[model samples]
Every structure is written in C-alpha cells, then in structure tokens.
Target: MNDISAQAATLQWNDQGLVPAIAQDWQTGEVLMLAWMNREALELTVREGRAIYWSRSRGALWRKGEESGNVQHLKELRIDCDADTVLMKVEQVGDIACHTGRRSCFYQRLENGEWQVTDPVLKDPQTLYGKS
Candidate 1:
C-alpha cells in the first residue's frame, strides 16, 4: 500500500482545497473526463477503488457509480511533478461517461480549421439525465 500521509503531503490543492483530476481508460489510455477533487474525494477514491470527484455546483463529493451505475474502477493514480493535477487510470463501465452521452468529454475537435464534432453520442442523454 502507498503511504497515505506521504501522498497527502505531496498534493498541492488550490485555495478552495481542490485539485484537478483527469480520468483515463487504463487499457486504451483514452482520456475520459476532467473533474475537480478535494481531499475527501481523493481519499475516498483511493480507499474505495472508484472514481470520486468534487462537484462544484452541488458543493459535495460525487461517487461516479452511485446513481447511474456507470462506474469508473480505479486502476492507478498518478500525480504530476507539481502535484497540482492528477491522472486517474480507470476501468470504465457502461457505454458512456459524458453528460452529453458520449464516451468521452473531449468529443469536439478542431478539424480542417473548423470546430467540429469528433465523437458521436454513444447513448441518448435524455434517457440518462432526463429531459430538463
């Protein structure tokens, strides 16, 4: 087991006591999404082997699979040299991870000097988030 105290001491959380976290597919190495994590979220993620992110809008820690059952199982956790950002390697469950019902959050791209949609939705958002 990694030294918890050492790991905690190394992190550089912002003034709000939050750090940026990037989630990626462990096998494919595809970046899935970006989120913020406070100390509680980070600790919960490590302890539970699941992806947990701090919800800025909700002002709470969100466990990925709690509602949708679209889970992200922790594979590895890496921190940059500065420890201001973290990369979480995860094994994602379900066809989509994005709120837009896409497989990834980075579904847009600049192509041919134009902003273009790169990834089509794998599932319907309405069915997931409900029409609002």
Candidate 2:
C-alpha cells in the first residue's frame, strides 16, 4: 500500500468509521478546530497538504475554506498514541478557521459557573459565507 494508505490503516476508527482530527496553528500552537475524518478525507489531506474533513451534518467531504477564504495549509500531522486522533499543525489563511468567523472553534470558556465567549469574530459570518 501507499504511504497515505499505510498511515491511515494504522488509525483506530470509531464504529462509524470516523476519527477525530484536531487542527492547530503551526506557529502559535493554538488549536483552531476539531473535526472528523474518514479514510478518504485523511488520505486526501495527506496528498493535498491541506485540511479535509468529513462533515457529519453535510454527510460529505468538507474542504476547509471551500466556502470561505480561510484554508489551512498543512505543516505537520501527528497521530496520538492510541491512533484514534489526529493532530495537524497548519498555517491558517485569512486568520479564520471557524465557520462563525472566529480564529478558532474553541471560543467558549467556562468560568464562575458560566460559559463566556473569549474570542472575537475576526470577520462577520454573513460576510464570509455570503449568507445575507
């Protein structure tokens, strides 16, 4: 098998045949987002040198920044010891990773028994997605 296929074969996929993938900023080490990947997505990501995920809601392959202008260029990919999770260090283009127009999907923090939004939206979602 090819390198991509060999690497993918080592992963421990869930019952749904999906594994969790985490995207982190290549320079800052800040986690940008968490998504799922099937074998196809994982192979495509390795070959294309970009982030590709399986969107459960859409039930299809999701190319990062396909709708917006915030593509993630892969720098490095690592698998956890258990081989069930993937961590990707990438250069985030347009400084946005979240569909909400935020730099990271982890925008919420819990403090004092309440959840608060910590990151500001870099761009308006409507503007990014052309929703309005």
Best by TM-score: 2
lDDT of 2 by residue, 19-56 (tens): 99999998999999999999999999988999999999
Q: Residue 66 deviation, candidate 1, in Å? A: 2.1
Clashes of 2: 0
Which RMSD values do the candidates have, in order?
1.8, 1.5
For each candidate in the order shown, give its overall lDDT on alpha carbons. Answer: 0.88, 0.93
lDDT of 1 by residue, 1-132 (tens): 333555866799899999999999999999999999998889888888999999999999999866667899999999998989989999999968888889999988998899899899876777776554
Q: List the candidate 1 regions with Cα displacement exceeding 4 Å.
A: 2-5, 130-132
Superposed by TM-score, candidate 1 places the C-alpha of residue 37 at a distance from the truth, in angstroms, of 0.3
